[model samples]
Target chain A: MTLLSVSNLTKSFGGIVANDSVSFDLNEGDIYAVIGPNGAGKTTLFNLISGVLRPTSGSVQYAGRDITGLAQADIAALGVVRTYQLVQLFRQRTVEENVQIGFHLATRGGVGAALFRPGWVRRQERMVREKSRELLRLVGLESQAGLVADKLPYGQQRLLKIARAMAAGPKLLMLDEPAAGLDTQETSVLGDVIQRINDQGITIVLIEHDMNLVMRMATRITVLDFGKKIAEGTPVEVKVNPAVLAAYLGEAELE
Target chain B: MTLRSTISAKPQVWATALAIAVAVALLAYVFGRGGYVVTVMGFAVIYGVFVTGLNLFMGYAGQASFGQNAFAALGGYGTAVLCADYGLEPIVALVLSATLSAVIALIVGYPTLRLRGHYLAMATFALGLITYELSIEQSGLTRGFMGFSGIPPLGLGRFQLLSERAQLAVFILIMLLGVWVARRLRGSRFGRALLAIGESEPAANALGIQVFRYKLVAFVIAAVYASVAGSMFAHFVGYISPEVFGLSMVTLSFTMLYVGGIGTLWGPIAGAVLVSFLPQLLRGFRDMQDIIYCLALIVILIFVPKGLASLWSLAVRRSDVPAER
Candidate 1:
């Protein structure tokens, strides 16, 4: 079942086409990866689908709903959540508090309820706290719960972002360079954590430069070169695709 | 050196604020009734409510709004017009005026909040000026620069808060209530979203938090708070005028918010009390008063940039294990 479908999506910044008529489909319960060299518009494609940028032309159908031109939060509420290429934590809050922010939409209360502290709000808060801890444990940051978010090491911060994003209870998680600044050790753990997330029935699409992680995790792969889809298939098929190889010519990581 | 950024309010700070609340209520009676000191404390509490609202917007939600006085003017004049001119109940005037402020905030915040930093500040500043001008220009309704008097004292049914003693109790109660409400909003889901927006808009957006909607709601909430403060000021002093809710209020409240702790829970009230009382303490200096005030603020800005609550953290640092700032 297709959870997300991008057809003829194109975005241009003046004369430069950041994303030029890209097309792809993300199926439910599958780990999909989009890979390309620098300036291949991989991040641009993520932005267009996640509602950060409006496409010049083309439509995004998420669960058969045409979500083109919708606001980023609206798209997220519809279950498509993304992370930044550069980590964006609350910076001042505790690690646990950062994840609690993710559970925002799942819980319901207004300004009045916050002050009133009704019975239900208390119960909901306790439940979210427990759930937040469970997520931290999932990402192995449970002990760091009391520490400020920014005080965490860079690798842990990246993992913290995943935990924070997971708090939103997303059906589809789009990760932008989830392994951008991590060591090989951190990257391996990240791959395992993501697979565990995928195993639990959430669909994922990640833009990554790490070919080994991609080749290991992606059940299906989409390759883009200069804002257009150059090749896409199962990992084994795309590894042998000549166009994908040509696009990665001097910058070869397609081995 | 590391004690500067005290973002979260611990239970200890709240206990201290409550103690101050009790003391402030007693303060009105300590100097005796009908004295000038109670009037000063009364005004401080009123500004407490106003700055509480401002803190919610600027401190928590991480949005800048310079025009909250617009709503205060709305609340003040709304109460004056309804009570003094039309013979409405004071309580009804307060509620209706706050509602009116909310509507105005919705319309104004929509356009003004789109800008960030200096631009947003300039837009809100203009909004405040426009409201001030309206208060003066709409002579028939607002009574113009001549001002409006004979506004009824705050009361319900037949019990008027006539005495300075009675008014002080009422003011303290209202200020504490305002603090409770702000605390509730800050500690819960609503507040977390605001803090997130304050830190990073894009991150909050990606998490399904509506950044624009949250900002507008915060602005409206802050405006309602300003309106209540405005009405309280009008009724407490028994007069309403354009100058009371002018740009100077913007300056005064910002001072109070920073001195107390911009984002800390007790900061607004703490700042309000200290900044309000400091002026009277320096009254002996006469001509040097403003100079002393400027130096004091500079000292605070240089040493405790996060506000007085940051000092509270410093005070408690010895007894407790230091956590990540």
Candidate 2:
């Protein structure tokens, strides 16, 4: 099933076009990756789809609903969530607290219940706490749950962001540079986690600069250059596409 | 999360808190007779409640608001108009006035809170100025700068709380209630979301936490708190004045939050008590009182940047360490 469909999406900042006429279809249970050089507008595309930025023109259809200009929170409530490129997290909070905050969408208690602390609210809070812990374990940070988020190591901090995003119960998870700062071992672990998440029936879309990781992990690949789609196909097909070659290599490659 | 486990892990802290609360209550009852000292302490309790509400906005929810005192004025004036002019019961006036303040907050927050950082601060500052002007200019309603007097004391039909000790007792109870509410907020999902928004708004939004709605809720709750405190102040003093809820009160409340520590549970309480007593203590210094107070705050910030709460945490850490030979 086509879980997310982006058609003719265009975004411009004054004279600079960040994303121009970019279109793609992501199917359910597939790992899709978008790769381009620096300034290829990969991150901008993620922002546009996640409702952090509105496109100058075109539409984004998620689960058959046109969610072009919806608020970021509204879109996230609909199960489309994204992690940040720079590891945006609640730094003063514990790792578990970071995850629990992400459970805002799944949890049901409000300010009134928080003030009163009735039995039902306590029960719901307990459930959220347990779920947050389970997510920590899933991300292999169960022991670090008590440590403050900013105190975590660089690679672990990245995993914390992913764990937080997972706690949001995203149906379509868009990861921005999840492996940017990780070593080989950490990258492999992250790849395994991503595969596990995909196997659990969540669609995955990522913007990654690591070509080897993307080529090895992504089932389908979309290539962008200068704010436009150059080529897109299964990784094997995209590896041999002439347009992708020229975009990645040099224009002289075609000559 | 770790919050539940930490609460369970240190059950002894609750015992300490209970003991301290009891001791403070007993001391207040013993010494809070009708005198200048009791009056200062009474004002401390009132402002404690007021600053606790502001802390919820600035510390937890991460919105710096300057218009909180305006809500207090609304509360005081609401009670004055209802109780003194319309002859309604004082307690009913308090509740209605608090509600009116919250409604006004909701209406104002919708437009004003969209501005971020310093912009939001300036807008709320503007709100404070506007409300102050309104209170003075609307002479028929607010009685202009001459103020509203003869407001009835807080009490039920037959049991009017007449003495300073009686009023101090009520203020203490309300202050405790405000602290309790703040603690509850800090541990809940609502508070966690607010903290998340404070730390990074885009992160909170991506997680589907409704940032705007939560900010509005925090704003209104803080407004109601300030209103209740204001109403109680009016009833306690039997008068209302625009000068009571002006820029000076805003500075005092902000100072309290900072001096004690912005986000700590006991920061506002400690800040309120310490700052409220400074003027009285410095009375002999006369012209040097404000200067001394500012210098004290600077010293505290320099030595303990996190506010006085850091000292408590440092002591806790030391106590947790094993003794060496």
Candidate 3:
């Protein structure tokens, strides 16, 4: 069954089309990968699907519900969450605090209840705290949970962002360049974590320039070029498509 | 940890603050000799409350607001008109005025909070300007630049908080309450949401946080706090004036927020006490007081941009674990 479906989605920045007539379907429990060279609109497609940017035309359906043009937060509330290309951890907060913040939707109580310290709020808080620790362990940063978020090494910061994203309890987690700027060892660690996350029944959609990781981990792959879908199929089919290879090699070469 | 231990952490902070406030009050009563000292301390406490409110918006929510003084004016004028003109109970005046300020914040923040960065700052600054002008132009209601006077003292029945000692005690209680509220908020889910927004609005939105709604709530809460402080000021002084809540007051509150640190619960109080007394301490220096204050602020920003909390944390870190920078 399709977990997320986008049909002919188009986004324009004035006269420039960032995403043009893009269409794809993500199935439930599939580790889907989106790959393209620089400025091929991979990130823009993520933004449109994630509701950070509204499509000019067409629609996005998540679990048979139209989510097109919904506010980003509202989309997230419906269990569709995205991570940014750049790490966006809450820098001043501790690593665990960053993860706890990700549990915003799961937690309840407001300013008045918080001030009074009611039993329910305290219970919810404890649950979130324990869950945050569990997430840290998943990202292999459990020992660093007490440290400030930004103080983590760059590769660890990327994992921290994923841990925070998971705190939201997302059914569909869309990651933009999660493995960007990682060494071979770090990338392998990230791949292992991603596989574990996918094994747990959460659908994963990611935009990545790391071809090796994409080939090894993706159940299916979609290729985009200059805002249009060039190819979509299983990883093997996408890799051998003549149009996909020409688009990458002729102008924007994939590293 | 279990629920019992988790709940204990926040209360411990508030208990410590209460203990410190009581000790400080006792010390002042014993060592301080005159009404002037008490009045100064009272104003310092009031300003601390105001700055703490402002920090909730600017520091925690990651929004800049320059027109908090306008809300403070609304607060002062709200109480002044309700009590001095209509002869209502002073406590009633306080509640109504603060409500008025919050309603105005909701209306204004809806549009103004949408603008980010410097644009939001400019918009709030304009709001301050408009409020100041309205206070001056609306003569019948605000008494214009001539000032609104003869506000009844805040009290219960026949008893009033007129004496400096009584006012100081009341202000201390109120300030401690404000501190307690801020501390509780810092640990709350709402506070975490605000901090998330402050750190990254886009990330917060992606995490299912209603960014604008949270911002509006923070703006309104801060507005109400400013209004309450103004109400306290009006009843304490028995007067209200536009000049008292103008550009200079905005600058003063901003300085306090910075000197104390933006997000910490105790920063505002420490900053208010220190900055409020600096001029009095430097009385012999005459014009040099302003220069010294500016220099001290510069040093604080350059050396410890995180404010006094950073310094305190550094000390604590040094004593325990020799942590990495």
Candidate 4:
């Protein structure tokens, strides 16, 4: 079943068209990768779909409902959570606390309830502690849970971002360059972490510069060039597409 | 997470806090009426509540507000006018004043809070100054620089709370309750969401936290706290003037917040007590008091940059700190 569909998705920044008529659909339980060179409108496409930016003209459908132009928080509440390309962890917060904050949607309590901390709030907090600890263990940061988030190494911080986002109880996880600053060993570990999360039945969409990771993890690949979709298919087919080849290696690659 | 457990979830910290509270009460009792130390302590607790609210806005929520004094003035004036002029009960007057402050906070926060950064501070700065001006210029109602007096003592209907020691005790109780609320706020899902917003607005939004609503709510809550503190101040002195709730109040609260600790659970209380008494502590130096006080601030800022609230953690990095239940 189609979980998310972007139909005729277009976005323009003043006169510059950042994402020109981009369209894609992800099936339930499939890992989708959107790959492109720098300035290929990859992030722009993510922004439009995630409701961070309004499309000049287009629509984003999640679970068969139109979600374009909705608030970023509202989109996230519908289970379409995304991690930023750069690390955005709450730096002063401990690792476990960082992940617990991601449980904003999963837990229910407003300002009033937070003040008194009645029986229900305490019970809710106990569950939150257990659940957050479980997530920390998942990403293998449980030991460093007491350390402040910024105190972590860069690659581990990236992994921490994933753990935090996962705590949001996402149905569709959109990762923006999750492996950007990661070393080779860290990158491999992250790939495994992404796989483990995908196995838990959440659909994954990622934009990546690392072709190897993309080819290995992505069940489907969409190629973008100059704000337009050049080609899209399974990893094997996208690898051989001439337009994708020209876009990545320049048109001279064909010769 | 709330510093409540992260630092003081252990028994030692609890004992330290209880001992401090009891000592305060003891001192208040021994000092009796019109003692300088007791007066300073009483004022400290009032400012503690005000700064506690400010901490929620600036420390936990990660927003700025220069106009909190505006709300304080509102509470002070509201209580004064309602109790003194209209013959309303002091308790009812205080509640009414706080409610009015909340409404004003909502009105101011709605637009300024939408945009991130210190825009709220800019708006609040104007508000604080404007409120100060109104108190001076509205001579017909407020009596201008002559000050507003004859505000009734706080009580339940016919019962009057007139004793100096009793008032100090009540101040301590209310201050403790305010700290408890702030600690509860810092440790909950709501608290986590707020700190998340303070750290990274975009990331927080992508995680399903409503940044605008939360900021606005934080702003209003802080204002209500300021309002209540102002009302108490009015009743404590039985008079109030425009001079009390000016930019100086903002400066005082800011100093208290940083000196005590910006984000920690006990920061406000620690800061209020210490900063309130710092001037008095140096009074023995007479001619050098101001110089010594400024030097003390600089030294503390350099050596204990996190403020006195963090002193306990350094003193006892105790193990087996039970998780907050």
Candidate 5:
């Protein structure tokens, strides 16, 4: 079943088109990769889907519901969560605390529970803490849970950001350049973790520059060039397509 | 005893002890002092409540506001108008005044909280000016420039708090309540959300926090605090004037927030006492007092950018843990 569908999605900043006429369907429990060269509107596509940026035109349907222009928080509450290409952890708070913040929307109580701190709120807070610890353990940062997020190593910060997003219990997790600055070993570890997370029944949509990682893990791939979709197929099919090759290697290189 | 186990096992006993000690000292001062000292202490206690409210908006929420004094003025004038014109009790006047200030905050915050950074600051500053002008020009309601007087003092049955000692007791009670509220907010989810928003608005919003709604709530809560402080100030001083809640008063509150440390709950209390009593401490220097005050502030701002809380925390760290250990 399709978990998310985008139809004729278009976004522009002033006169520049960032995402133009983009359409795709994401199936349930599938690991989908979005690949493009620099300035191909990959991040813009993620932002549009996550509700961080409103579309200039077109529609987005998640779980058979249209959610084109919802606010980021509302979208997040509806189980669509995205991570930044640049890690954005709460620097002053501990790793555990940062993860717990992501659990804020998932807590049992609404505003009343938050304000009043009833018995249920305390229980919910305890549950959140336990879940946060579990997420930390999953991402191999359990030992560093008490450490301030800013104090963690750059590679660990990336893992922590993924763990933080997972704390929200998202149905669809969109990672923007999850392995951007990692070393070879760190990238391998990240690839393994992403695979494990996907195996746990969470649909994954990722934008990655690492072609090896994309080809090895992605069930399907959507290729983009200069704000338009160039190709959509299985990783093997996309790797062999001449248009996809030209988009990646450029027309002169193809010639 | 592994390093992690040792560090994690130790309770925050020192912070608890220090808080208790300070509470005791405040209690001793309230009961021991007489005349002017008690009066000054009363002012400090009320101002402490006022500054803590400002701290919630500026420090935790990361929205600078210069209009807290306007809220304070509304509270003071609300109390005076209610008590003098309507013959209501001071207690009733206090509640009504706080409600009035909160209503005004809602009106102002709805449009103003949408603005970012300096635009928000400038908009709130204009609000402060408008409130001051309205208080002065409203003539029959606010009594114009002549100022309002005869705000009946607070009382419980036959025992009215007319003396400095009695007023000090009431002020202490109010300050304790303020401290309790601040501490509660510090531990609450709403407080954490505010801190998150303060750190990064877009990140917090993406994490499912209603950023604008939280900001508006913080703004109104802070206004309510200022109003309560204003009502207490009017009753304590036995007068209410538009000038009491002017730009200088707003600056004084901002200085308290800065000098104390922005995010900490106890910082404003330490700041209010220092700024309130600095003039008396420099009374001997008469002609040079203003110069000395400005210099002290500049030096503190330069050396202790995080304010006295950072220094105090450093001192506590040194005393609690051995230098080599």
Candidate 6:
């Protein structure tokens, strides 16, 4: 069943059309990849879907409810979460603290709770710490929990971003270039983790330039060129499409 | 415990105890000195609360605001008008002033906070200028340039809090409450959210934090602090004037925040005491006092951009390491 549907979505910045008449439906539990050449507006589309940017004209229905023009925080609270293309962990905060911040929406202890009820707040904080630790373990950064996020190696920072997003308890996770700076071994681990997260029933949408990881892990693939969808299908089908070949892979071939 | 853990935990206690000690010292000074010192200390405590509120906004939420003094003026004038004219009690007037300041914050913050960094600074600065102009022109309500007089003093039963000692006691109590509130905010989840937003707003928004709401909350909370300070100052001195809440007071408060530390709670208190009392300390210099004060702040800012709080933290760190070693 379709978990999110976008119809006739259009976004423009003055004269530049970043996304034009884009239409797509994401199925529940589907691991989808959006692949494109540079300036294909993949990130812009993610921003629009995630409510960081309002669509110029169109509708976005998430979990069968129209969510167009909702605030980013509201969208996130609805279990739709996205990560930045650049690593955006709180550098001064510990890795565990960074992840625990994502639990703010789920945390029942407000300012009053933290102030008036120390025992309750301590218990809740401990629970959040345990959850953060578990997520850090899942991302293979359990030992680095106490370390400041910026002190981590670049690869670990990327993994921490994923762990932070996971701490939000997302129904749908959107990652922007999670594999951008990883080595082959780290990429393999990330692929495995993505599959594991999907196996646990959360849907995933990723924008990536890494074709090998995309082809290996994506259940469905959408190809974009110059802000327009060129082709979309099952991984093999999109891989064999001539338009996608001419526009995307052909450019990759040249570079 | 591990040495690292032990060192990390020691600072929290030491810091709290040290703050309480400083507060006690201030209390003792108020009791020891005569009227003039007590009066200045009263002003310092109120301004300390005002600057503490601003520190939360500028240091924690990463929003630059110059209109906090405007809110202070509003609270001062609001309380004066209510109690003197409308026959409300002093405490009721203070509460009303805070609520009014919060409402004004909501109205102003909603639109202006959308502007980024320097734009926010310029916008709020203009708002402060406008508020000052309003105070000057609105003669019927604010008494314009002539200022408001005949403001009533706070009292309970037969004891009027107008005397220097009583004023100091009230100021100390209020300052302690302000510190307690600021400390609470510093450790709360909302405080973390503010810091996260200050670090990177987009990342904070993506984390499901309502960045605008938090910013508004910070702004309003700071305004409330300023307003209460204004009310207390007006009553303590039994006089109110447009000149009392102007750019100079705002800049002085900002300088205090800079000198003390941006995000740390005690920084404002330290800054407030220094800014308020430095001229008196240098009273022997006569005409050169202002120049000396400015030079001192410039030097402090140049050498310690993080403020005096960093120096305190560094000292604590050194002491902590040696003890652990």
| Top candidate by TM-score | 4
Q: Estimate each model's TM-score.
A: 0.88, 0.88, 0.88, 0.92, 0.90, 0.84
Residue-level lDDT for A132 in candidate 2: 86
Docking class of 4: medium
* Descending-DockQ candidate ranking: 4, 2, 1, 3, 5, 6
Clashing pairs in 1: B260-B271
Residues B69-88 of candidate 6 have per-residue lDDT tens digits of: 88999999998899889978
Clashing residue pairs in candidate 2 (N, C-alpha, C atoms within 3 angstroms): none
DockQ, each predicted model:
0.50, 0.52, 0.49, 0.56, 0.40, 0.35
lDDT of 1 by residue, B241-302 (tens): 89999888999999998888888777778789788888887999999999998899889888
Per-residue lDDT tens digits of candidate 5, residues A108-149?
443355557888778877787788888988889989876667
Q: Could you give candidate 5's per-residue lDDT for residues B134-181 as a string of tens digits?
A: 999998998888888887787755668978788878887888788777
- How far residue A167's Cα lies from its native spot in candidate 3, in Å, is 1.3
Model 4 stretches with alpha carbons more than 4 Å out: A118-120, B1-34, B115-118, B318-325
Please give the clash total of every predicted structure, in order. 1, 0, 0, 0, 0, 0
Query: For residues A56-78, what per-residue lDDT tens digits would candidate 3 score against the true structure?
Result: 99999999999999987788888
- How would you encode candidate 6's per-residue C-alpha lDDT over A1-255 as one tens digit per residue? 999898988999999998888888999999999989999999999999999899999999999999999988789889998889864788877677788887878676555764565787778778787888888888888877767677888888888899999988899999999999899988998998888889889999999999999999998888888888889999899978888888954766745
Model 3, retained fraction of real contacts?
0.72
Q: Model 3: how far is A94 from its true place, Å?
A: 2.1
Residue clash pairs of candidate 6 = none
After superposing candidate 5 on the true structure, give the runs of residues whose Cα lies further than 4 Å from its correct spot.
A7-21, A53-59, A68-71, A108-115, B1-11, B315-325
Report, to 2 decimal places, the DockQ of model 5: 0.40
Give me the runs in candidate 1 sitting further than 4 Å from their true place. Answer: A1-28, A53-71, A115-119, A233-242, A251-255, B1-34, B315-325
TM-score of 6: 0.84
Which of 1 and 3 is ahead in TM-score? 3
Evaluate model 4 with DockQ and give the value. 0.56
